[model samples]
Target: MERLLINIKISVNEKIYLKDPESSDLGKRILKHSIELIHSIGFECFNFKKLGKEIGSNESSIYRYFENKHKLLLYLTSWYWGWLEYKLVFSTNGISNPKNQLIKAIEIICDVIREDSRFSHINEVKLSKILIAEYSKSYLTKEVDDENKEGYFSIYKRLIIRIKEMIGQVNPKYQYPASLASSIVEGALHQHFLREHFPLITDCSDTKTTTSFYSDLVLKTIQK
Candidate 1:
């Protein structure tokens, strides 16, 4: 699955569209079209010709911005992370203290999962499997680095660091929770969004209310 991820990275730049939101650049125009197409038609149903027609561009023009569909999917997913990171960073303001920051961290991550239906757009485990497949098939492009997926990773690193940091602050000598505190919280959150929401409309295992219940449990666990 990871191999599929790397196999898909065709080179393109984000600024091609941002340079001018209106009639600015071919690259930007195609990128904007690509995102809208994916969101509207979904990953499985999207096609270049249909996308180009909708955007009033030719198929080759769309391909000029992205080599193919899968690569576009990768870029779009990464783009979401960029937007998310911006919100999270500003929301938390970089608190160094662990306990004080943990709540902010939880709020930042959970709020995104709950309020945004974006998570429902793709299956994370399947994507993770695809990421693993891509790694198996080939290596990631060098350009896909710190900025590429920082939004997704930074949240994980921040929580883990703060988990241990707060554990220490609360206990003065904290051991990593036997449960691996970070994963427990993240896993529960994932379940609420990924499995709990729908009977068949979603992969969610339980029901939508699971989020509220999980939130309360997490709060008590982290309470000082």
Candidate 2:
């Protein structure tokens, strides 16, 4: 699994960018510094000019990869989903029990992220924070319908589908596996945000508690 993840090349939709960021060193530097900029300032405030200054490049260089900050956000978030799906596969490999696999999947999405040295340029921890604070913006825009048509969200949707399949295996009679699966992922992010800003709204104050809350929530919802 580690070998697979290290070698995994997650393909992003061509429509999202003018050029592939993984295709060259400059492009990879753009991703590396862009992650730092977004993690420091935020998605709303991050722009190509700022990123260019941070990476010691011109705005045109950044534009060579992404058309706009929105597309860049899409790329980053899409990459994260693909990486997460990889982790999900790795975490659940050879686990025949569907319930156990489902539990592990929940934990992967809900728990604190550990930095993977394999992706040295991409900080999993910072990316996870961006996901918690900014993932919705990637899809909440008016262009989402058109982007969806172009498979911009294929990786994310695929992850949800994988977990939805596990839910079906656990509870063959459960009629809302898709909805339940999506809820688990989105709810985990929301719960994380609440834990940080509105602690009283959620029971997730730390990694262990957050993992327990989500794991129990999914098990009870599907297994009941």
Candidate 3:
């Protein structure tokens, strides 16, 4: 799987960046350090100037890649989704059982991220942390509708649809496949956040527990 992933390029929407960050060494540095900085300080306090200082690049150079921090967040989130989609597809590709496929998909999305050596510059672990804490800020804005129209959230929506189809295969007559699919995706993230910050309220203490919770919920909810 690492060999396959090393050859794959996680593509994000071209519209999200002024220049493709993956296209240059400096741009990749921007993405790498930005993830570290945001994970360390939180996105609310992150800025290009800070990122630039961390990467030892000029602020203007960072702007050459991303127009602003919000767009950078969008790019990061979109890239994460794209990378995850590949994992889901590859991991479940030959599984003929619908229920098994769905379980694997849930596990992939809900599992705690480990460092992927294929992409050395960008830390998948830190990026996952950012996604858990800062993903909503990427879309919950006044321009979200406009951004949606431009397909800013296409990869994420596509992932939900993939899960929705798996749900339908599991229970063809299920009335709320789409809702269940979306809930599983978003709910996993929320549950992870709760586990990390408010452990008393969430029973999920780790990745195994969280994956088990969502997999059980999904199977029960879609059972015929």
Candidate 4:
């Protein structure tokens, strides 16, 4: 950083870090441009030099926030998951019935993917692979790979357990545990939104259709 800025006689302003991160407005802007650029061309091909040139910033600016390409992708992927956790928490409150909760979870996931183009199978598959691969190492740094692991997982677990209990209520002789039901539910939703089921349903562009289909399918599948 010092070497690159030295040629232009630019000095590091400690106020940016020592004072307020908001002071690094240029750095923040560069990060935004970096996200846009990577989203367009993909993280594999996005070039900070080009991004800086297009955004009217220096290459050093992007590098200031992100050390390299890998770090940039990590930040972008993490940001998407962070937004997902928020939507999940907001979407499934006051709906405590296990059946309703499970349906709501699928519905909310579909609605979220509809709103974010990056939530497509391409990004979903990529992010899944990345998360699975990094989960061991990332969890070592904290309790989970994603930042809001406990907050989201607790509600999610409760919802799943409740759903399985509801299923058992309908079919008292069912042998499998609720945790297995949760796995099935999560897996089904993931397949639908992130795979072949998506392209077949163009009407699902709206949240209504998305949630409706998800809810109907979930209810039907869980019905005894």
Number of clashing pairs per prediction, in order: 20, 0, 0, 0
Q: How large is the C-alpha RMSD of every model relative to the true structure?
A: 10.4, 1.2, 1.2, 12.1
Two-way TM-score contest, 1 vs 4, winner: 1
TM-score for each of the candidates: 0.51, 0.96, 0.97, 0.50
Lowest summed lDDT window (length 10), candidate 4 = 9-18
**Residue pairs with backbone atoms closer than 3 Å in model 4 (clashes):** none
| TM-score: the better of candidates 1 and 3 | 3
**lDDT (CA) per prediction:** 0.48, 0.89, 0.92, 0.50
lDDT of 3 by residue, 1-224 (tens): 55677678999999999999999999899999999999999999999889989998889999999999999999999999998999999999989999999999999999988887788888999999999999999999999999999999999999999999999999999999899989988988898899899988998974448899998888887784
Q: Where is the poorest 10-residue window by lDDT in model 2?
A: 1-10
Off by over 4 Å in 4: 1-23, 112-213
Quote model 2's TM-score: 0.96
What TM-score does structure 1 among the candidates reach?
Answer: 0.51
Worst 10 residues of 3 by lDDT: 1-10
| Model 4 lDDT per residue over 66-182, tens place | 665554544544444444445554565566766665566565545434333422222443443343233223324453545344342343345456556655754556566475556
Residue 219 C-alpha lDDT in model 4: 59
Best by lDDT: 3
lDDT of 2 by residue, 89-133 (tens): 889997999988888998898888889888778998999999999
Ranking by TM-score: 3, 2, 1, 4
Model 2 regions lying over 4 Å from their true place: none
